[model samples]
Target: MKTLLHAAGLAAWLAMSQASAGISLNGTRVIFDGAHPEASVTVRNHGADILVQSWLEALDSDKAELPFAITPPLTRLPAGQEQLLRILYAGAGASDQQETAFWLNVQEIPQAAGKGNVLQLAVRQRVKVFYRPPGLDGDALQAPERLRWRLRRERGNSWLQADNPSRYHVTVTGLTLLSGGKSKEISRAQMLAPGAGGQWPLPADTANDARLRYQIINDFGASQAFEARLQGVAPAQPQRLEP
Candidate 1:
């Protein structure tokens, strides 16, 4: 499966927790249907009373105003149960391949009882909509024009580094096992720009038998696959065992 790498600035706010009594949005993800995009908003209640609120704003990728807002007639979310708010873009005139941002602003509501309201709050979330064209297939990769990798061992720790000095983005998608067999994918990522490099931390228990195989995918629907062997030994302990 493919996942979009979130821009650096937006990652911080998306990781916040909203389990408190005040209004908050959590577990937000964008789903694109090629023609229309849907933003699912979940509002959690951590207090004793129900939540009644109104419209929220949605923005585009450039931080511009989207012509849509999320205003359900009656948003009554009971304590602990989440309310799923769906915002559709069917009527909104937009392109399929273009990327846009959807921002949400949650309004606050006053408490029903005579006591002062403590549930007044506002939260924002963003979603990117992109179109996925058809006729794409997955296949094994060929070697790239240039390939370089390194393995370094330290005190009970090792590092694996890979570099792609070519002019295309590379995808590493597979892993090889240590016991003369292949294993399922452990991790995958795209390497951007020429001269870009990445480092992977190796576990202390992994000895000379461990190995990793990776594939490099380019933007033009081509890929390169290779393997890297890792040799490790346990860090020497100062004391010897008594027999």
Candidate 2:
């Protein structure tokens, strides 16, 4: 029989929450201003002594790269103490046209093993990091309200395409698609940046009379709901069989 610390068991434990939580990040999101080449994030250990590992991942990449560097990538943070991790961008993948985003993951691992039948799990926390380029256009706070939405059909599937024309990122949550007296909601949160767009799969019939309602995550991480109907979008027509 495999113990709870086995590979599979550990994987399951990683997915669950531990009672003795210790690590916390300063901000829900990190912004890397273009004018500066470095940014810092503060990590606080509120419970027991633990080792925290930090890394950065591109939005669509599976692995973390070195365009950015974290000071003391792995460090032991004592209880009630805090560590400031500096992030340096070498301009490796920087784009002058629009803003780019990445994910910052901080994992906390306990340092001591208690003598008992106690289960301890490592806690991993992830946050978004936005790299803003100079002279992109518009204010970050107004970006969400400037977003444009459309309902489209491709390859027999219906989708909602959200376009962000500003230089700032607009995080959307609680999105719902309403049509034909029926309503469906998005399962996860989405974020769109300047000149960037994302497609959310929707019901085929919903394309005909689709209206989208969602909340935008502001610079402070607060959600504000808004509703709008897709504009300049044509509904998909069902194929007809020839007799």
Candidate 3:
């Protein structure tokens, strides 16, 4: 078991690092190949000697029990030193046609402060681990562009509908609607599972002939942009944006 420890949001890394006591992770996210026996991640300590802990948790409590195990969950990491964390999955019958995600947690437990009134904070880094079954259809990296999009109106409110027909999961980072020289940003951080769909609210005054520009989180943990023209699109039908 081995790969990157993918953080859910990069901003979280910045917020936590301000404390000046933390560990550095090697990757933005983890991709666990189903056919492989294990995945690995590199964890490095930047401060004084401390005890580090690593574990995995199910993304959804309603889902099946996590069949993954992380070795050496507890270890002592010296200052300026790093260790390789290994992950082993039991292949818990995850969907053969789609990818499943989990939370990979690595926490820092610093040695007790010697002085009185000293505060010791244990900072933990949480990232996503995508378990991709072997031989799935389509390209995972291109799934975001392949999504079907449409703008809909309901009860005086406009909504943007996104339908992902691909076999991989896609995480959206940003969405903006541009029409008639007006641009409106929509707040939505979401992950679309294969063949699943979601909707986001749009400005009530959105133009009929609008242009939609959005960004999706790529495998490398960066935002990739896509643009689409939304004019004369039927409310009930999904359409792919112009290439």
Best by lDDT: 3
lDDT value for model 2: 0.77
lDDT by residue (1-243, candidate 2, tens digit) is 567458878766655545458988988989888888788899999887899999888887775563777777999998999999988888776777777788899999887686877667778999988888867767786777777777877788877877877877888888887776778989788878678878888777674656677777766666777777664384322121122
TM match of model 1 to true structure: 0.36
- Flag regions of model 1 displaced more than 4 Å: 1-19, 22-26, 35-39, 52-65, 69-74, 112-243
Each model's lDDT comes to 0.47, 0.77, 0.81
* Candidate 1 residue pairs that clash: 59-103, 61-101, 142-224, 171-217
Say which prediction, candidate 2 or candidate 3, comes out ahead on lDDT.
Answer: 3
> Which run of 10 residues does model 1 get worst, by summed lDDT?
234-243
lDDT by residue for model 3 (56-98), tens = 8888867766878898899999999998999897766577888
Clashes of 3: 10
Give the winner by lDDT: 1 or 2. Answer: 2
What clash pairs does model 2 have? none
Error of 3 at 39 (Å): 1.3
Question: How well does model 3 score by local distance difference test?
Answer: 0.81
Residue 66 of model 2, lDDT score: 38
> Which portions of model 3 miss their true places by more than 4 Å?
1-19, 232-243
